[model samples]
Target: MTTTLPHFEPFSPDALAHRGGALAEGPVALGSAGYTILNFELATTVLRDSRFQNAALKLMEDFGITDGPVHEFRAHSLLMAEGRRHLRLRTPLARFMGPATVENIRGILREIIQDLAAALDPSAPVDFHGGIDQRLPARVYCYLAGAPVEDAAKVARLSERTLSLLNRDPSLTPVIVAAYDELFAYLRDLVARKRAQGLGEDMLSFLIAQHDAGKLSEEELFNEAAAMLEASSVNTTHQTGLVVWTLLRDREVWQRLVEDPALIPAAMVEVLRLYPRPGVVSRIATEDVELNGTVIPAGSDVHVAVWSANRDPARFENPAEFVLERERNQPLTFSTGSHNCLGQGLAKVEMEEVVRYLVEHFPNTVVVEEGTDIGQAGGRWLVKSLTVDLKP
Candidate 1:
């Protein structure tokens, strides 16, 4: 309800605090790239509007996932699908990652978090990103995907490689291709094993059943499973680091949550708002549409600056600051519309549990540095590292 000037960098957090509110006034055209809608209201409309299609293929081409095993692997991604095909692929996977699934595996995930927390040495500085944040989500998703938990380290490495291919660098194309092959092969074999051994209650098994029912082809099943790993592993892993950084940076906020654990859920939402993993969510305008007095031609690529929108004054009071109990707080972190993140519920459970465990265990945590993997193509900003000193 409070208005503030946009003083932060054009797309940076600081810019969001000061200039974000202005977005509600209108949208801006970014040269040939397309229109960028920063206003909360406009962005919401753009995302939910069926006219703006998911430019998955455009993004893939832009990121160089054009051909090879990686392309084949991504061909059936729920992220890339449209119409009934998107629903067909998304439905079973969504059911697997739905709220019930998260709740069912909550206890198992708690054990994973507790184990990671227990391993942290209070007397030393820990690479919280690698030691816990990264490990926790990867392991949790691995468990959910019915993959081998013991192979988490390997899967994490492969997930990184698979995501990095999105960079679209020519030199790294071969490396990216190899990584995709290795990952696809790994999941393919695992799917085969699950089939031979009989599917279980896990997500991978659910997809396998869908395959058996002739609802999905075997290749689609494998691609979706791989996509699940790539999708779930990367965003959750990096976002966890960002969430931890947000908490540790504001010592008072950290202390408050530690003192009252009930605040964790709300606090997590706020953290996600300020540091949504994917800074920008894009779509292609299916028709020439007039928005906020601007005419967007048909087939024009459009982007929503999520980071800026989350801080729009029109949406939240004191959008820059991390307020745990902000009323009517609905950050576009998980995005909106049909293509919104399906695994958000699971992400919430994972983040809430991991964050609470960290603050509770490492009460005296201090952030030494925040690391982001450079040159990642537009989606989630990868927090490659976060060094934090822990206390007894």
Candidate 2:
């Protein structure tokens, strides 16, 4: 079905860029056809408020986007859930994903980074996403989910295909669908095996035990596994690119890291603050609410533009500059509040480890061509397609 709503002003990235990156001061209206969109909040507020929904399904319907391999998988992740249902599932996730717990996992994650970076051939042009960056979180996610490290590359391929739903052609749905089924089935069987072994220490094993103990349903286990795999794989890879991009363009950031290797982790935080991969997490307003003096009526779609919010002058000094030492940059990168990413802690650990290795090993790495800006079809800025020459 087409959009069922009122008319409002149009908002597009092209238009905004053409106007020197400034848009109207309030929530810019986006019409699906001729609809008033809804009483919306800035993307950042929408991300934090419980009233809003991801409305991904609603968006697909309005845009006449039919089922495809990638879109189908996206429908299963926690990133798309709203309200009580989201909370119900996310609570346990928070248990293992807390900051302190993640901090403890750094030793193992560091080992992975050291091993992987040691394997890179700096003389050759490597596809950073598929080769280096993807490996950063692929092993971590596999270990967390109780999957075999031997299968990380295979799983990464499935993830790449699934995430392609964001910008891939609708015609590729069949291929991705087939890959997803195989991937999901393999995970389900892995969970079963872990259960048969009488419990596991990893997250997937824990999920399996929960399923058997009635804490989680069968459907929940499968979907959640897919969700975990994809979220862990794609977002991390994209953020790795963000770090590289930031470092390549700014010699000072690189010099700062080289001078103080201990600061790589903090530099990574700055990267997250500047260029987060996952698109703005949005919510559908369930009720009318006032944000910064604007009353958004119920059922509005709110989005907290991660990039914009992170750069808001009110929040950070010199918002546009990349400050690895910024002590007050409370980036909305991992978001805040109840639904904040359950895997953020683990993701950060992986990032820190990878960044450390990259700094220590490739101190003078430079992007030869500076690569192309692989712009996202779905407004994800971090999913850039760029190739560069790496050298000392």
Candidate 3:
């Protein structure tokens, strides 16, 4: 018997709200983008299963980026690697993103946050997204890559334009192609400069060292650096903005964090659950797989609706409401299993520090609703603008 999955358009305008309603229909759905996993349990299962591979390469192919530097990069990048190859590429980068390393960067995060925040006027509502969130992650990336601090803006722009491919808009192919070319050129020059200055302790220098030690081929070395740089900032930028937008509007929760800063981590997790930046994690089914009594054929595109899974009633109590005290509050915002986000720990610590800074410095800050614009598209939540009255 063939089980007919319900039709779902994950990229719909009201996708965030619609995903919750779709869960009631079933765990799996047929959509234009492909099959969507709607429940937390199944989403986790699919994310952990190696049968489904990252669809990024396929997605690029679909967008007419079949043969080019962009195509070659996607084909060889860590995102497409598997098993031993994946671990090999991931290990060197993992050291810098691990819990201890991320924790040690807290003081540095604080200083960066303070520096970004210092530029804002306390007496007026400011565009928090642009002035702070948009810039912090790139600066952090610059530090990690041992690049000049002055290059932060270009790094942010390249990261944004390159990763904008996730928007799934074919029209942006030209822009995307151009961005990757520029990114490759920028990274190549940066690597050359690092070599001239001699190796250092920064992440890029470490990758260079790995290449010199023969652990990573010269090509693999550039690929690893390019992959890391491309993914470093954009998502973190929006996610940080979302955290502030959600917490500021929820005055009661805002007060709790303000009163007890220890709760910021939990609060951050809750915000991630409610408004995950990467709402959809797309995968390609390499072979026929039966999921929840439905057979997904080979070469099928499987999108794990992270936002929906995080709010699945079967998994989370009071799926709609934000509850800070929920036990086992892990969200798929950073994904799961082997291919999970490498920078999650660092990103979380960055957000927590930002929250902590706000709580200590501007506990009375409130969202200026009129100037704030938050929206969802292509199953991703984005912050267009976030205005906050720091002293209000």
List the candidates ranked by TM-score, beginning with the highest: 3, 1, 2
Candidate 3 lDDT, 212-252, residue by residue in tens:
99999998999999999999899999999999999998999
Better of 1 and 2 by lDDT: 1
Q: lDDT tens string, model 1, 177-203?
A: 787788877887898898899889888
Q: Global lDDT for candidate 3? A: 0.92
lDDT of 2 by residue, 58-164 (tens): 55444344566445655755677666777777766777677766887788887887777666677875555555677767887777777789988877777777666
How does model 1 fare in lDDT? 0.75
Off by over 4 Å in 3: 19-22
Q: lDDT of each structure? A: 0.75, 0.64, 0.92
Stretches of candidate 2 off by over 4 Å are 1-24, 33-44, 59-85, 124-126, 168-176, 288-300, 370-374, 383-391
Worst 10 residues of 3 by lDDT: 17-26
TM-score winner between 1 and 3, please give it: 3
